[model samples]
Target: MNIYFVRHGSTEGNETDQFQLPTIELSERGLKQAEVLANRFKSIPIDIIFSSPMMRASQTAQAISLVTGHAVNENPIFEEVNRPTAVRGRCKSEPEVKEIMKIVKSTFTDPDNRHSDEEDYFQIRDRAQKMLEFLSKKEERNILVVTHGEILKMVLALVIFGDKITPELFYEVKRTFVPDNTGITTIQYDLSFELHESGWYVLGWNDHAHFGEF
Candidate 1:
């Protein structure tokens, strides 16, 4: 299986650095980024395109669909990590950002400590895991998944490191794994190698060669 993991383009919340709202569509720049991204994959072999139910991802997916001629498939399972409803559209102060980061950190260590309105870290991890499960179950050779940043990192860490992701590793991903607007990460699972012998291979990591620097 070949997978193209893409982070959705910028949004108003993103431009203002507000906490994720989970329903905002792409920004003007985001739409252009998606177009460039779509052009990048115009000739690649993709059998299907999947997207989070969020509008940001759906619109980005539509940009790709315009090029691939494949319809966007929305799956709630691929939604971004859910924050507390109250914090959804609010600007986070330094302390508030720290608190959110704390919550983000908690997701890596304790999956059961889901906040009042937010999902449990473990639930988010499991949701990321399920996306991979859904991928492996599909027979499509090439697939694209348009999603948010947090879930993409979680799922990519899971794919790169398997079930052995520890807090240290999660932090490493948080620190270094940067998927800019419309950046693409490609991976392939080799069937020739035993499921245990040869596993997934990462062809690219946050590549934006098609559109230069973000």
Candidate 2:
């Protein structure tokens, strides 16, 4: 089984570095980026297309669906990290936003800590686990998932480290890895491998070769 994980295209919030609103859609450039991404999948056979229910991800998935002729399945599991409502639509550079972000970062040391309505580390970890399980149960051999950056990172970490993953390690990975808009990350599962052998292996990460110079 080949699982293709793709980050959604750029949004106004992404371009401006603001805390994204839940209903935010893609920017004009982001729409073009999605079309380029869809073209990249023209040669690759995708049996199923799954996307975050958020508008940005759905837009990206729809672009691919138009090319691939597969209906998109919108699932909440692929949604971006549940940030505090207070910061939604706010600029990241604002003092209030900065302070909130600092608190959020500090809480990463403790998985159970929750500052407000935002999802804690443990919640995201569990969601990542669920996402893997969901994919494993799917009958489709070629699955394409369009999601947001933070959830994509979580899913990758869960796949790479399994039960051994810790909050600190995840924090480090998140800090080091910034998935580009419409970037594709792939992982493959070999049915021949035993449970102990861990059949899943990462084939690629953050691949954006489809967009030449843009």
Candidate 3:
């Protein structure tokens, strides 16, 4: 099975570097980016599409579905990491928000620590595991999923490092591998390697060459 994960396109909050609200919709450039991304999918054989229920991700998935001729399945498991509600729609540059973010980052060393309503390291990690398990059971050979950056990062780290993925390490991976809007990430799973391997291989990550079309 080949899984293609796409980060949702940009929103107004993205342009302003704010902690976006779940209900936020994509910006004009983001919509165009999604269209460009879908155009690239014309050459790939995608059997099914899945998306986080958030508006930005759903809109991005819908754009791809139009090109791929596949209906999108909205799944909450693919939603962005549950961030503290207080930061929603707030600019990251604000001193208070910065302090809150600092506290949040400091808590990364503790898997169960939570500053507020945000998802703990362990919870998000387990959710990533569940997502992989869900994909393994699918009959489709090619699957596409639209999600947010943070959870996408979590998924990649969990797939590549598995049990060795500590909270601290995950933080670094998240920091170093920032995914762009509409960037495509691909992972492959082969049944033959199930016995001796995780059966998952990172074929590609954050491929956004289609952005050149804009």
TM agreement with the true structure for every prediction: 0.88, 0.95, 0.95
Would you give me the overall lDDT of model 2? 0.90
Model 3 misplacement above 4 A: 109-113, 194-196
**Mind giving the per-residue lDDT tens digits that candidate 3 earns over 1-214?**
9999999999999999999898999999999999999999999999999999999999999999999999999999999998788899999999999988888877755756667878878889999999999999999999999999999999999878888889878978988999999999998888687642788878899999998999
Prediction RMSDs, each to the true structure: 2.4, 1.7, 1.6
Candidate lDDT (C-alpha), each: 0.81, 0.90, 0.92
- Writing each residue's lDDT as its tens digit, candidate 1 over 168-208 gives 78668978987887888887777575654336667888888
Which window of ten consecutive residues has the lowest lDDT sum in model 2?
191-200
Question: TM-score of predicted model 1?
Answer: 0.88
The top-ranked prediction according to lDDT is 3
Better of 1 and 2 by lDDT: 2
lDDT of residue 202 for candidate 1: 76
